[model samples]
Target: MDDLNLGKKLQMYRTSRSMSIRELSDATGITASMLSQIEHEQVNPSINSLNNIAKALGVPLYCFFQEEIIKEPVVRHDSRKTIGRPENAEEVYYELLTPDTNGTIEFCMMVIPPHSNSFDSVHCHTGEEVAYFLGDGDHIGITIEGRTLHLKRDDSVRIAPFSNHVWHNDTDQTARVIFAITPPSF
Candidate 1:
């Protein structure tokens, strides 16, 4: 990975969110001096530190590795960024419909396998999200703030910022959904 580019992207995201270095440090549990050094490209951040930074910035860890800003507007289907594979606790797969996390809104297509959950535990982020379920004759259950809601085909639900939520597929059929979030959180 190019340390200079990573540092620049980090600074850009942080400033876009109007977050100071100290605030980022507090959020990621990293030291302010270390964050500053990383931002300045004085030192390369470790994987753990990078993960914490990505979580604090509300962007995917891969966003830091994206080499350049997308000059083209369209993200081809074959080239769409995919994440959250078998290595993760949940086997849910996510394909980025948008080019990158540089924009105000982020869009993704999520595929949840049968009898699996979107997350291993309750997930909460700092942005408002809307999920639209797709596919015919299939459904999934979403639990938000301790209340479980069933969603069928073409159903859409809005989740408020920081509300704990999770998506679960109990049926034998795999579930697919399109998600849009402001200030992207992967």
Candidate 2:
């Protein structure tokens, strides 16, 4: 994470979302002056403040720390960055396949271990998501808005925006999927 560049990235994301500083402040419950100071690199926001800002921006908290801005169009597999997850997150893992969020869509690779779930609770975000199962069989189950759908290899699903969704691997092998989200809300 580049501490000095955080403010610039914040400003970029805020402007890309068409949100004014005042609007962000109102949404995050932070003072407008403080937000301005953060954007100007005059102050360092605490983790709590950053979490609030991430929630307001509809992105993962790790998005702020990603330093690769994707100057070129290609993203190599070996160079792909992985988002940090909790230490206890042994069931699921995520690898960011997209080099940057400066585009309309973000891509990621999700791996769910056997008999494990992606999340403990169903979650929803601001943008639409499409998931493509890459496993060999219908071992992946995705629950969206209380309906569970079994997905096999080459199967894809388009999830509505803000729909509660969670995935699980019920088989004895790992389940893999390629997930894409519009507006880069991941």
Candidate 3:
């Protein structure tokens, strides 16, 4: 994410809703002091924290990083917007393949590190998603609802809305995957 503008956008969104930092903290389960730091750009927030904040604010997570709507048809790889939390143990990187989140579908590439998982707990979003595993060699594990599924190169899985799921890379090699989601939840 753009650290320079993240704080400004967050502050604008929070104040526009007439909600205080404490109120946002209560709604997002984040500490008020930490939220203040995030608003002031003193520290970077984890992906989970940002997701919670976005959900609580009723806004998409990409809004903080997206500067403007793209009028062009093509999005260059170098110009893609990215957001990640390096502080987390499972440091996954995501790059937007689409210009912005305003489109009907959100497309992005995820890079999962070796022996890493996407989140600390089960994750669920309002939008339905399809994740396609890319590259060769190692297989990735995805647990949706209560079933575990292994995906190899070229394998894909469709995730229903609000289904608890997590992505795992158990192999020593890094795994790459692409995700397409409707309604652009993340």
Best by TM-score: 3
Candidate 1 weakest ten by summed lDDT: 81-90
TM-score of each predicted structure versus truth: 0.66, 0.65, 0.86
User: lDDT at 167 for candidate 3?
Assistant: 90
Query: Could you tell which candidate, 1 or 3, scores higher by lDDT?
Result: 3
Report lDDT per candidate.
0.80, 0.78, 0.83
Q: After superposition, how far is residue 20 of candidate 3 from its true place, in Å?
A: 2.0
Cα deviation of 63, candidate 2, in Å: 3.7
> Which pairs clash in the backbone of model 2?
none
By lDDT rank, best first, the candidates go: 3, 1, 2
Question: All candidates: CA RMSD in angstroms?
Answer: 6.6, 6.7, 2.4
State which candidate, 1 or 2, has the greater TM-score: 1
For model 2, residues 1-186, the per-residue Cα lDDT tens digits are 233377887899999999999999999999999999988877766545776888899877657756555566788987665543323345466677876666778898887777877776687777899999997546689999999999888999999999999898888887889999887764
Model 2 residue runs over 4 Å out of place are 1-62, 65-68, 85-89, 136-138
Q: Return whichever of 1 and 2 wins on lDDT.
A: 1
Number of clashes in every candidate structure?
0, 0, 0
Residues 120-165 of candidate 1: C-alpha lDDT, one tens digit per residue: 6787878899999996337889999999999988999999999999
